[model samples]
Target: MPYSPEDKKRAVMRLRRIKGQAAALERAVEEGTDCKSLLQQIAALRGAANGLMAEVLDSHLRELFGSAKETVAVREARDPDEEIEALMKTLRTYLK
Candidate 1:
């Protein structure tokens, strides 16, 4: 999906938080932190990863389903001469 700048920023922030959580988890593991503490960290990290995955999957699905409308709008807005030229270019490419 082509995300807006704000959406991209939010996604980056989410991933950054997830990365921090992962780093903390790694530290806990190396230091032999209590099992319960490790488990909690694992759960939190998994949740964050799942949330990000869901968001990205949703965006991908939206792009797949929504692009038809976007394509139509673009085609409708194009100048006739431009459209003809585009079509000619496509034909030339296909023929080659």
Candidate 2:
């Protein structure tokens, strides 16, 4: 269930699109776009970011659980706090 080359390419493309949206957001602010319009753009960017995150999580889940025996072991060893900490660290840069 590992990601294929096509998956990598698609992820890269999505990232590039997100980068462009970020640049557009900057430009909108600089050009004094209406607050509502700016907020809408921001929302769209957030959705895109969330979609990327979902894709990554789905891929990880597939890698960890697609095999029947491994899936059971993973569930038995689940650690919610540890998982949350890992996610927090991974996402901290975005907060800054």
Candidate 3:
């Protein structure tokens, strides 16, 4: 489930920030910045990327199942084991 134009714009803005942070990290390395400080920045960038991924996943789940609580209802109607297996397959395919 791709976002609307407005949502895409917002996500792009976040990605731009992450890009800038990455550039800063590069500059810091060239300038001999402390390893600990660079590591912290890298960790923060990873967190930001994870947050963006979470948003994407949440959006996809909502599009598929309507909402967070509604997902439980959908899952309940389906066989739990089968659903888990199907989800794993889907994840594997998506990752590839």
Q: For residues 1-84, what per-residue lDDT tens digits would candidate 3 score against the true structure?
A: 457887687778878988988999899999999999999989988887877776676666555555555656676786667655
Mark the regions of model 3 whose C-alpha exceeds 4 Å error after superposition.
67-86, 89-96
Ordered list by TM-score, greatest first = 2, 3, 1
RMSD of 3: 4.5
Clash pairs detected, candidate 2: none
**Clash number for each model:** 0, 0, 0
Q: Each model's TM-score?
A: 0.66, 0.68, 0.67
Superposed by TM-score, candidate 1 places the C-alpha of residue 10 at a distance from the truth, in angstroms, of: 1.3
Question: Top model by TM-score, which number?
Answer: 2
RMSD, one per candidate, in order: 10.8, 4.6, 4.5
Which residue runs of candidate 2 sit more than 4 Å off their true CA positions?
A: 68-96
Instruction: Summarize candidate 1's per-residue lDDT along 1-96 as a digit string, tens digits.
Output: 329787688778889999999999999999999999999999999888877766776675565445555777765675767655755674466345
Q: Can you write out model 2's per-residue Cα lDDT over 12-92, one digit (the tens) per residue?
A: 888998999999999999999999999999999998898887777678655544556565666768776776676667568
- The better-scoring model by lDDT among 2 and 3 is 2
